[model samples]
Target: MRFFALVAASVMLLAVAAAAAEYNVVDYGARPGGRADDSAEAFLAAWAAACNDSSSPVMRVPAGTFLVSQAYFKGPCRSAAGVVLAVDGVVVAPSAVDSSAWIMFHYAHGLKIRGGTLDGNGHAYWACKSKTTPGRRCPHGTTTLDISQSRGVSVRRLTLVNSKNAHMAIFDCTDVTLRGVKMLAPRDSPNTDGVHVQLSTDVRILSATIRTGDDCVSLGPGTSDVVIRNIKCGPGHGISIGSLGGEAGEAPVRNVTVEAAELTGTQNGLRIKTWGKPHPGLVESVTFAGVTMRGVQNPIVFDQSYCPGRGNVNCPGKSSGVKISDVKFTDIQGTSATPVAVRFDCSSTNPCTGIMLNNVNLTYNGKQAKSFCKNAHVRLLPRVAPRRATAYRPALPCQLESRPEIRLVGLRLPVLCLPVLRLPVLCSCYACPSRASPSARDRAGDPTAGPAPPSRSPHLLVYTHMLVIYFQDILGCGKFKKLGLQNEEALQKCFGDIISVGNDHWSPHMVHGAAAASPSNAPNVDGNDTQDIDIDLTQDKATCEEGDTNEVEQISPVNANGKRPPRPAPPKAKKQKSGTALTIQEAVTSMATSATSYASTKQGKYSIDEVMEHVIACGATYETNEHFIASELFVKKEQREMFMTFRNNEVRFSWLTRKYMAKYGN
Candidate 1:
């Protein structure tokens, strides 16, 4: 009974703390319904009060349209349960443009922004920019919600629309979760990326429906462990890893997975793009699985030679050095607007490796799909597009010696040695029988020869074996003739420099005296048609000390294995083939003419015209509704509008015309 009383008392104290922590904007002099001096200040004051409370706090904004100007809710809250900004009200942005963010949540932990409409009045800025001709400039507005440098933050059930720039920019944060977020913008709006995550990790975006001009979910440099699931993105550039490696000293994006996504009428899908400049970073372990695309222009691509804003003028042909490896695309069934279903344009200097395409069935124009690859090692499963895929195999395995020999101590009696090429030691031996009557080789050679007693020579007791090692390649450094090491002196120097351990307690056989054989005229294994072979050793040299006898002499051709050392097989030669080798001018001309002229030749049921019409129709329904509502307010000749009277006794109008009428005249 005493323990039950203690539990009840603790529960009562928690309830009392929760009640004391509640701060409502109505009690703080907030006037909703489009008041000029709106609830922006009052809402901020309530957030401050609730954030300072020791218990879990709730700052509630009741259901009403609250006109707010640039407000920032800053926090390092004292609440253990964090501060919940339970906003059921529609927070509308002011028409007065500023360089500051419309709404920013900065430095907050355990923060939750939920249940509201964040309306950025971007129509005015879009109109001002639209009216500007050449040489005329218009000031652009800021992002809708700039949440930066906060950990353990969640923004849920929020409708963010008409952002001046990116809708929600999550920067330099960790453990951010955004669920059931709807980001809406015009398809033609410039630079309105939906959810941009940069310099952040462990970000999860679930059940998001994004319609915008730019990428739906863009992961910039230094982003990793990002999971995007159940996303429906359309009328935008689809999810992208980067336009990375644009500048020097940039961090790489790694371990990003986007699964169960449906992209309709998107410009691109599942893309990883790096700039044409050089960056010494790496993008690794990215997976795009269970993605469905409807009329996506480029369904899968890895463009290491990406130059976004700059067109094909003076492209320099310089590729990014950011090594992208271990990327996977699985279960991606889609239709591409263009004939090229998948393109992998990797770097020349830093070629991409370990790219896997599994169960990818993309079609173009009702015909079997095709792909284009450049400087990347790609593995494709049978279900992938282009049923007849000639997979990329490396031209050379490893620079190995043709005839490798090792030194072993010899006993007077022959010992049986088995071939151990695949073993670590490379040679194995067994003790010979001591009771043999005659020499085994002589007895086997002559039928008339009788068995003789085995000679017990004490001199054949034992010999000290010295370990001599030889290796063709270690790590990536080897003798490639293209690097200009051809002479005997250069070969010796290369061996001594490259194949050495830290200590000199042992001597490597190949390092001191080994000569490369004359390279065959046959082509090497690298996919290119080059005739030059890198490292091919033919001879081995072993030295014996003075006390070593004739039986245990160095450089013997035969061993106990009784098998002759086999020569290394020559690399199979293959010619590098390019299906589409056109210059930029030709590509541009082809793109312009391909739509009209190429449509007639398409064997598919839907023509290019039909595909484009379908793509445009995908976004027209929502865009049309938004345009219809926006046209009534942003008219050149405006009539009277309904004005709302706030509790602060301020009568305010809710349209762009309201600001225009107060400034100009009707």
Candidate 2:
């Protein structure tokens, strides 16, 4: 009987509490001609007074343009169950008296600013310049809307427009959501980023349309668990991450996701900006899925020199000693400005890792694809491109602008004309230029054609849904000659050869010493050749004397697995061959182009017997002239001859030689 009574009492109390939790509606104007000013400040004050009162109703801003200067939401903003600040009205700033911002929210929880237009009324201040750091009493109409130091806040279906400064500045807030918000700024408006989210966590920005002067969205340091999804961005600096130089020793940005966005006419598509060297702050574990881009310049970019003010002598951007790691980009197809489709600049001291790309396909307007990361593990699924960039500058728009952000390759808008190259052509707008750029000739010229294929250049920025992506090309400083390729060829192969995963079996060998030539690459061809060799490697240095040759001899032509490696050269026989008279690279290239392709030639009619006789005859000739290897090594003559004769086809001969060599001491 006691338990039953207790349960009944508890149930009754809960029911009463639920019933008492109801919405209150506070209407500003009830008295005729006593209309309440619908300014942002006025609404905020009225809303605050009523929000805490248990008897206070949900404040409603009626459908009128209320001129508001600045309004702050300082309370906990714990909605009274069914109560919401429903603004089916327009809140405009005052016409004359300076206003800092239209709306500001701080230290609030469980709040939603929905269905409202916060207009800066900015015919007054869009063109005025603002410094990187504003003074204490900033001029009126500077920051349009700033929400800082808040949590569990949701601002949806709002149109925020025409601010002199940033359209929306969100700082140090967590668990915030911005859905269906349209942020609009002028194409040339200075410093007017659509949304700048800094040092925030667990934030979701979805289905927003932003056209701004600066980045559509700038994700600054210490941002974590952020998701920017399904957005339309154009006429902006695209999406940006980490101009990071100021904040070191802070928790880095991590676990960010950008997905399903369409972008056009933006300065870039995907970008990751760091300073010279890297900072202690890191950017890791980011993803870009299902992003479509059109007519964006330098769709990919990474600028390390973040803060280069007027007299920045050390302009390559400071290396903050930070590492960018474990990033992925998938399903991004678009038009980009430069030859580099994807470029990454991890500090050589603290390099990045775990970069993967599966089903990566991109088509451009005949510009080189400078895609791939240096000194990192990059996995590229099999690529199917009909054409490749044979050269870079003649194909890309690299250095056309004088941007302060060094370590970033700057691309210019509206290419003039591409001077007969192998890649796509586009009007560039990205700024990814080196500090020591000599001439503007690096900027590619315009060409009349459908957007060409992506270039093979391994160093340019890439963007997707407002996320910076590319470990594909960790391109910074490198000696092309040491890599066994000319500048352009090295750039292409540098992107093509990186391993595609973590430091696993397929990863590149990381050494303080130089990298070795890969067997999979094409042979060394003449730089001035009409037909290219398939190999991608830097040129080997000259062997001066016996000492050099001895050192070279110690290094065998085999990988770690000890596979039968392709000989770089046949030491003695090739010297006497007709090819020896030409340059070494020409000889190698001639051999490569002459090799049989699957489609070009037919299977031989000769049988196994004929091949056996040929092998025997070659062995006898080698034995007569050579002292090192003999006929015995050719496979036990009679058994090899008998077995090889009848099975002279390539497969049969190959298997017999392998089987004989395994059994005998050949």
Indicate which candidate wins on TM-score: 1
Q: Write the per-residue lDDT of candidate 2 for residues 1-666, one digit (tens) a residue.
A: 999999999999877765444332224432111224444445655666556745324556666566564565555554543135667766666543343344665555566777878666565554333334454333443556766666777888999877665678676678989999998878866666788776679999999999877778878666899899999998887887766544334458889899998889887787777766443668889987788878776665554444444445444444546677787777777766544566554455565566656444455565345453333335433233343322222433222121121132333222122122222222222222222232213322322222334333323432121112211111222232133223565444434442222100000000011111222322345664457567433333333444565774544566889885765764554445365556887867777776744212322332334444555433323333211122333333323333332212322222233233222211
Writing each residue's lDDT as its tens digit, candidate 1 over 379-444 gives: 544332232122111111122111222223443322122111111111112222232243333343
- For candidate 2, the lDDT comes to 0.53
Deviation from native of the Cα of residue 427 in model 1, angstroms: 40
Error of 1 at 210 (Å): 0.8
User: How many times do residue backbones clash in model 1?
Assistant: 7
TM-score of 2: 0.53
Model 2 per-residue lDDT at 352: 59
Name the regions of candidate 1 deviating beyond 4 angstroms: 1-16, 308-316, 384-666
TM agreement with the true structure for every prediction: 0.56, 0.53
Q: How far is each candidate from the true structure, as Cα RMSD in Å? A: 37.2, 35.4
